[model samples]
Target chain A: MSDLTQLTISQARAKLRGKEITATEITEAYLSAIDRANPALNAYVAVTGDKARDMAKASDARLVKGEGGALEGIPLGIKDLFGTEGVHTQACSHVLDGFKPRYESTVTSNLWADGAVMLGKLNMDEFAMGSSNETSYYGPVINPWRRSRLDTVVMPTTHQGDGGFVSAGGTRTARSLDNAQLVPGGSSGGSATAVSAFLCAGATATDTGGSIRQPAAFTGTVGIKPTYGRCSRWGIVAFASSLDQAGPIARDVRDAAILLKSMASVDPKDTTSVDRPVPDYEAVIGKPIKGMKVGIPREYRVDGMPEEIEALWQKGIAWLKDAGAEIVDISLPHTKYALPAYYIVAPAEASSNLARYDGVRYGLRVPGKDIVDMYEKTRAAGFGREVKRRIMIGTYVLSAGYYDAYYLQAQKVRNLIKRDFETVFAAGVDVILTPATPSAAFGIADEDMAADPVKMYLNDIFTVTVNMAGLPGIAVPAGLDAKGLPLGLQLIGRPFDEETLFQTAAVIEQAAGTFQPEKWW
Target chain B: MSVDLQTVKRVARLARIAVSEEDAKRMTGELNAILGFVEQLNEVDVSGVEPMTSVTPMEMKKRQDVVTDGGKAADIVANAPATEENFFLVPKVVE
Candidate 1:
């Protein structure tokens, strides 16, 4: 009862609707903390544990007939780019090897019709193409945050029973720390290392650029993305369809506003979703963002950025000016051509949504001497070398003598980075702030980001101008560096304003507080 | 605006994907360092900028020439690597 994987999905939906915890004991305490931290955080490439205990025994018979639903028996995870009917939806790509869909991914069928539960899939950045989930083929996921060792020794402990801590004379070992292995930032690096190592009570992610807010600002947690047709990319996996969307990564900011009010809706098989109406974003967290306005931008203070990400962007602009808001420095001047115009419109729409992986229909296949040498030896043995350097830089920027010099001059520098956030939210901005990832989580094949691919696409330079201005961003965490890691910040909003980014990331998560990774996974 | 090694082996043969000759000579220096970092959008002037086409401005939601869906031919070849009746088998293109 003390550590059902440290609760929070609105405290395990109020102890599974007050029957005091029985959605199969928080789905066997997140399947025994994902069987003891999934062999050091490889973050669930698939562990449906009999479909999460038969959907936590049908959410304990719909919580004994009170008929529950907003994430009924919680559990979550899902980001191997969504799909999940037969499970393993492979965007973690070995060209979808061993694929399995038979449908189900209108955002995990709207989080399994709101009763949630799945606890599987979760590793990404293969098709969702890297920011740093080390372009996974179900391999590199590890960041249960490590880097903090100047010969560490912090004994005094005492918080055990799986919320971690231990020592107080229970025989040493409270913090030896530094094992190196950093990178949790990514294509939702396994949903920010399974929600900062609690092993999932909230997961499902996807972004496109800044894949779910730079892996929820490198594993501190709380993502967002939304507002590019606010969710419903009809079953996820298709990076850069005008900067992909889907949200949630949780562990605060009201469990990412109750998992984006049940992973947003409006489908008709995704005519770019947005049919509107999705607000109880956990009823706007703490609600009073005083007189709002926020903004700050000054071209996101970029150059060499890191005085602890400009002292955590001046403590998230002094915690949203001590919650009474109105900060305003503004300017967004096409923010450094939004990461070289999002590496030319996300590899020119990832070379036409990866030309539907050409091995005739489904997953992998490599035989040749015909059908264009079996679609060039099954996409050269099914992608990965950062998906063939983004399908050869999205087929040489949509070829034909460089489609008007790199995809229509990177879509007119993505319409001047969406007219510099529509002239700062048409002046009188209600949310912009910045600094999500210019630094903080690194090292996992980090040799200057494996010797440059635009230095790992400049880790989405402060979250790709909110996915090139379709708007609504987020990120959160906002502090902790000098090697203790976790930094975050970013806000952005407007355009179906994700409730002013969960009411200003709950006032910078109530003044930079909620960060968790000390449990050396 | 770089990309050489014969335009990275002709854009990996128009992205069908195989790229050898030493991975098209290391993807012609990683596609000329991502086309020299998107050639910094040619120092932006975007002459009367427009190109965005749709990041959200709507008006494209058409739907009428109905069919709606189809009888799942085995859930669309279930995950075709070689299927037969459910169709997908390939490799011998018109020869």
Candidate 2:
């Protein structure tokens, strides 16, 4: 009765099982919240209100029969990247305009099998190619967290002819914009926002080059990019195939664990899905991390990292050390090159995978004099600027005479990056800790990030190495910055060792405490 | 390693995406910035490193080549912009 939307997935499970709340009631609560908040947040691209109600009704019947699945009656947001049969699954790209898959993604199918209710598709970077969520075809999702007005040092009252802003005096003033609109960190920005704002108990998100973790850190939620192949990529829209992995964004570490348990499974449809039993991640939530060797990678201490982020990293180390985790300084020398290499490798794979979007098969079609012209026109019209930029880079790298210099070189660098993690992990490091992002969430359409694509790409610097290594990583909200925005610390685990991440992240979550943005919407 | 305007146009053509002269000029600079960033990969000695074919260490899983799924022609073409009797309609390639 006390705002059913506030209940974590684990608590909702108990309450639903106890018959204290009906699935329909909770579903309606979330629907009402979404209806009210979505207009301001732009989180949900398409709300499946009718389907959610029908699913909740079925869940209620199952509960009455004293039978339920692992996530029975829990409502969740699906990233638009996932294929949900007969629903919008565009990966937030215009190229897939009006496209609906006839089959569900394996990850979503698994969630439904466990009784999770679909609350509809969430927005994301078009083709999962951006870090600021500004690349979303649906307008960028607004971060629920805002910088405190009291911390304002500069404010712009009027827009200049350029992207810059100026005060009425025609000069920049030292006052921050009053509650400036901030971007929810992206590609999975919507998932992070929805979970952080309590619009959904949890949301499914994918990470390729830190899509899940960066946004989770920005929005103050718990998100994990499980080991590559932990969740089948069968129906998820392909980004960088080698780096993409589906995970969950939830309000708490325990909620994230529960959602992940339901989201991950080995599927025959996806050959890359590992043939291993999915562990009960939630069961390890409160496990003590005594004697756990938490590695502090020295290479992650990149130059010009904010003092606060560095402080937060130290806080994480101190918390883990207090929990009896032995802090060991380790070196991953290839860290600086991971982002640059990712820029090459991710775009290369993305270009090849996106070739299927020719106007012939599905989605948008533009008329031209011939088939080739039509394909060119359609693609040009369909893709956004960032998508086109990535495709261009991808195509250029994989083109004749450049493959060895760019694509091949990046792959070799990727191997070195992965080997760095292997060396540290082989040396008895249980998990590694670092700041999830270099800084807290910044303003939507911030000038610097907008001027240059590379500036935006740097947002994933701390989180991409895990993807390159094919390891599991989680971003747990550790503390608030001076501006009241949340900052998160990431924990990287070994392959198929998400249970260890859950155990370690839970410790940090407990120590730092859960964060919730003050509801401005 | 920076891409020139001509190279940008060529890459866009190879990618099957049309680009206007103005956009191509702009992309030349953007692509150069990205290429310049990734050029740092040349700094590291990758002489003995093998390009990663797969991220995780696992043998490719093989399955029977037999058709296990079909009878969904309508579903397959359901979202296509133009379709005729389950066949996708496309602009004439040879004329």
TM-score of chain B of each: 0.36, 0.94
Write candidate 1's Cα lDDT for A39-150 as tens digits: 8889888898988999989988998999988888888888888887888888888878988988888877888788988878888778878877878887889888777755
What local lDDT does model 2 show for residue A29? 97
Query: What's the lDDT of the predicted structure labeled candidate 2?
Result: 0.92
Task: Say which candidate scores most in TM-score.
Answer: 2
lDDT of 2 by residue, A1-521 (tens): 59999999999999999999999999999999999999999999999999999999999999999998889999999999999999998999899999999998889999998888999999889988888788988999999998874532444466678867657533332424346899999899999999999999999999999999999999999999999999999989998899999999999999998988888898889989999998988899899999999999988888889999999999999999999999999999999999999999899999999999998889999999999999999999999999999999999999989899888888999999999999999999999999999999999889998878899999999999889989999999999987888999999999999999999999999999999988889
Q: How many Å off is the CA of A13 in candidate 2?
A: 0.5
Residue-level error in angstroms, candidate 2, position A213: 0.3
RMSD of 1: 23.0
Residue A324 in candidate 1 has what lDDT? 85
DockQ of 1: 0.34
Candidate 2: the clashing residue pairs are: A153-A174, A153-A175, A154-A174, A154-A175, A154-A176, A155-A175
